[model samples]
Target chain A: MKKTALLIIAVLGILLLRAAEDLPFWGDPQSPASVHLSDYYLEESYEETSVPNIVTSVLADYRGYDTMFETVVIFCAGITVLIVLRRTHRRRAKVISPRPERPGADIILQTAARLLVPMMQLFALYVVAHGHHSPGGGFQGGVILGSSLILLALSYDIQMALHRFKEKLVLLFSAGGVLLYAAIGLACLFLGRNFLAYGAWAALLGISEPEAHSHGMLGVEIGVAITVLCIMFSLYIDLASGGDLDEGL
Target chain B: MEDLLAYIISRYNYWAAIILLLIGLYGMIAKNNLLKKVIGMTIFQAAIILFYVSIGDKRGATIPILAHGHDGAHQAVEAAAYANPLPHVLMLTAIVVGVSTLGVALAILQKIYRVHGTIEEDEILETIDQ
Candidate 1:
């Protein structure tokens, strides 16, 4: 009864709040939002840094400082996952598998995995590569890749999936991605520019003028995508591994 | 009045996203079950993604591609007509962040479940006290 009353009151409060705000509920053709962010990119962004892909420009150049921290956060997660999932050499015997197989899950799963895994992996690669031009990108592509493994785990047993690809590799890849990003930043520092400065790389790589910025940004975007993908995989392993119970260390 | 209704109907995605977000928040605050909390978290994250996608919308814009026209030069279009890729870019990062945080929370919840054997917040508290 109290829950019902609270729910009603909450609904009323929400409605009142919506009524009070004069926010545009629909897409207004004349609104400030209709302007393509590209205009800002073409005019201001190019002058500041000459990257062609504005998203990459913003991520790698304009806001690379934030991105450094974002990379660090992902690294923190990878470390945490490692810490939580780490198994001591002797304690490997105590690591219990979650579910015991009943009957013919093996034959059925083998047939399905044979057909599905290749197609999913191909799609993920397409998403990663075509990200600069389309609605998809490294993060989305990475999740798709990570979730494909999840599809495997649900269909097959966890032991089979773990055997196919170790979590240690995923953690290593994730850490490597972050290290690559920092290395780029450090490289920029060596070249006498700010951390993650693309201009410095352009000069070092002998990339001239406008194209230099584009290539530099692309490199960083690759870094971002890799980190995002590995982090997503790490997250999946953490969640789907039944809370890392009995994994010593 | 008819036009007003049409406008509202046309942009139902944003409305739905906002509604979902509110509903998720309400559930998060009101529900006592840890499972329900996770459900709310998913709902909220998905709603936020919807909101971000809506922000990327431009009425008649195509994907911002620098494809060549018949002349083999970059086809120029009105700047106002291109979708804002910034929101999508930011949202992509946010989605990954959301998943990671949820993974950590769910991991901790598993530990809690193991220790207490009940997923209800109130029940756990009661058990702890006793």
Candidate 2:
């Protein structure tokens, strides 16, 4: 069976290589991907959205619907993991080994986490806020924020992290993030424009249309960050504790 | 022979992506362990993401960000001067989706292990049969 699988994979690889030969060469400025809509996005995104980062403008403005659905997808995954692994009642037979009790939290690790977590969280916020001008963005920033909590969990314990961020709050934040994104679109709809049309927001907020697009993108990016941060930490706790939420690795 | 070598050199990123993809496929297909399969799936995703991001690269271009802050809109921005941002944006979502999928898969794996007391695919199948 393994040999057959290997043979199939080899044939697939060869076929894929052949297909790849027809693709544009690496770093070709005139490649199909570099042309088409890319030129439009590069040249007009700054003017249209007032966001200098073309990727950010294109992601959260031009493709706002796609991003909103992407947030929903993440929310669904978080809820799915919660449903699949979370056990309210304790099982009589524990298939996994019991988490061993430590004597106490290590002073060195706790102190380090205490010093580092605040810095990490501050940097995460900076990344999210400066995403329009820099390489940083919501997803990257959210992951960093989530890892800070994970670091806390690692240094102290699951209970410690849970005490800081409750399980109910995590679920709320996850759902709320998606809600925030959709609510912005609904607000645009209510203001006599199409859904997710930030130009309508300019009238309401008393700003230029492009600035409104910039602010709208910022709002949605914050939503994405909130969902990602909560879901990431939630996944860690659930998996580490094996649904019990008692202790974690 | 020289032309073929030049072609290969210019498109090495695609070749690297293909090799990584094949390794991931092999692991997914041949591994008996569920956890290994999950890791293989991750590797597969990484390869695809790499392929996509590589497509956005331009030889003599800077990043997608405008050089002159907000004033860049006033200037005549050359499209070829900047790398493609579309693929980068698409892959950002893909990376997040990949992480979420891995989390869900591992959660399911935990449930399977709890019920079956083993994570080996063949063993689980045997127990199911019995």
TM-scores for every candidate against the unseen true structure: 0.81, 0.96
Off by over 4 Å in 2: A92-104, B1-5, B70-73
**CA-based DockQ, model 2:** 0.83
lDDT of 2 by residue, B29-128 (tens): 9999999999999999989999999999999999999877433437878999999999999999999988999999999998898889889999999999
lDDT of 2 by residue, A1-249 (tens): 799889988899989989998999899998998889999999888778888889899999999999999989988999999999998655635455546666776899899999999999999999999999998878889899999999999898899999999999999998998899899999999999999998899988899999999999999889999999999999999999888887887
Give the TM-score of chain A, superposed on the true chain A, for all candidates in the order listed. 0.73, 0.95
Backbone clash pairs for candidate 1 read: none
State the iRMSD of every prediction, in order shown.
3.9, 1.1
lDDT accuracy of residue A34 in candidate 2: 85
DockQ of each: 0.39, 0.83
lDDT of 1 by residue, A1-249 (tens): 338746864785578456525545444444455455446753455445543345656666677777767767766876676566544557656555444334656677778886898798789888766655545655666677777776766676555666767767767777777777788878878989878776786666776645556565556666766777667655665556554522211
lDDT of each prediction vs. the true structure? 0.65, 0.91
Query: Model 1, residue B43: what's the lDDT?
Result: 93
The superposed Cα distance between candidate 2 and the true structure at residue B118, in angstroms, equals 0.9
lDDT of 1 by residue, B1-130 (tens): 9998886665677667767877777677778888888888889889889876776666676664433333423444456555665775677567667767776677677667666877898899999999
